[model samples]
Target: MTEVRSTPTQRVAPEEPPPSDPVAAAWTDYLAAARQLDGVRRGAATAAGEQARSVQAAREELTVVRARLAAQQSRLRERGVPAMALVPSPPEVTVAARSMAAGPAAVLTALRTARECADAADGVLDARGWVAVVGVWRASRPEGWPDRLRNLLVYGPLAVLGPVLQVVLVLTGSGARIALAVLLGLVLPAVAFAVGWVGVGRFFRPGPDGRLDRTPRFGVLVCGVPAALCTAGILVAVLTG
Candidate 1:
């Protein structure tokens, strides 16, 4: 029996059959993966662009911020604000401390109360074009000859006197005429600036609430122009002499 028996055959399980549309299935999977990868790539690129734009805008804004700060610093320097003025203090400020508390306190308290009352009363100023207080308070009246003469008497001499004093000071202190002339040169421009600052503030301002007839006048004509003209004449005389 052993001689006649055949070797035992090995048994193998059948493999799973491939899908009928195997190529289509593989192509579908490949396309889905490609779409997912494309979505991720687009999102990353968009985020990078948005970040770059934000950074660029911030840089541009920084330049404007720096310029404004520099201008403010320059103004403060020109005004010569004291270091002590920058020291932090309580919100309450007392103009006079004499006797530690009395009439001055009462006056200041009254003034503050009055200001608050005025502001509250005139809260509609912008809405009413500044007529909400005291029956339409107005600008400084255009002055006639007498008033003009009075102002001129007060302000005109300042233009001439300031430059004269500066020139005299230079003449007395300096040995060389050239140095004196240079100082005069510097002083005239300074006088022009001073005259313009004061004159424009006091005389050339537009009327209250920017009225129709409130166009600014040439305040410089009263002070700056005269000073400049006189300085020019003096310059010519001194240089020629």
Candidate 2:
């Protein structure tokens, strides 16, 4: 038997690869994509972590400042001084600083000049002037956020109805349309007043200073007045038509 096998020893060739190892290719491709996705996820996570840390730091700093302010306020109260009276007004720097001989007379003169300047500044910052300043401040502030989202909840169906009313009035034939138009015409200003008052609170919310500063009333005037005028124009058009 050993001799017969030794006479002819033919080696079998290795098997060829499959036509297309699609499953293998797919697995390799999936692994490559997974690697890329993991890299992206890691990068995003790092960025989000950095932003979170920054926000936390700012919040901590604000808390410290608030605590300090509260302590100062308590101290002021303990001294029996009215808190409003003790709150320091902004510093007044004079244009002219004359070198005076160190004396009581010089001190008195300096005090009088400073007081006069303060009075003038105060006169400039009355209600109307302050309203103008608030307008300018509000103008510079960013917008385009959803306003009084809670109001949307409270007004619910009415909010839906308000738009629907307009749509219905628009669709109806002339006479009924005119009636609906007139109703909306009267309702709009009161709606505006309510909305504006609610909106003002968002603008006047506690800023850096804990005091309540008036929000820009200008937004109301800017948006509401024009809307009212447009409604009136529509009414006029309807009447004329």
Task: List pairs with backbone clashes in candidate 1.
Answer: none
lDDT by residue for model 2 (169-241), tens? 7667677786776678567645755665565556445445564332334433433454456467667767788
TM-score of 2: 0.28
Worst-scoring 10-residue span by lDDT in model 2? 92-101
Per-residue lDDT value at 119 in model 1 = 49
Could you tell me the lDDT of residue 103 within candidate 1? 41
Give one digit per residue, the lDDT tens place, for model 1 in 1-241.
3567689999999999865898888999999999999999999999788666655654555455456545544544555867555333544444333332544334444444544544453454344544544243332333322344434543566556656654665456454754554556556655654664555346643434662221123233554565566556666756777
Best by lDDT: 2
Candidate 2 backbone overlaps, count: 0
Worst 10 residues of 1 by lDDT: 211-220
TM-score of each model, in listed order: 0.30, 0.28
The CA lDDT of each predicted structure is: 0.53, 0.56
Runs of candidate 1 with Cα error greater than 4 angstroms are 1-18, 82-241
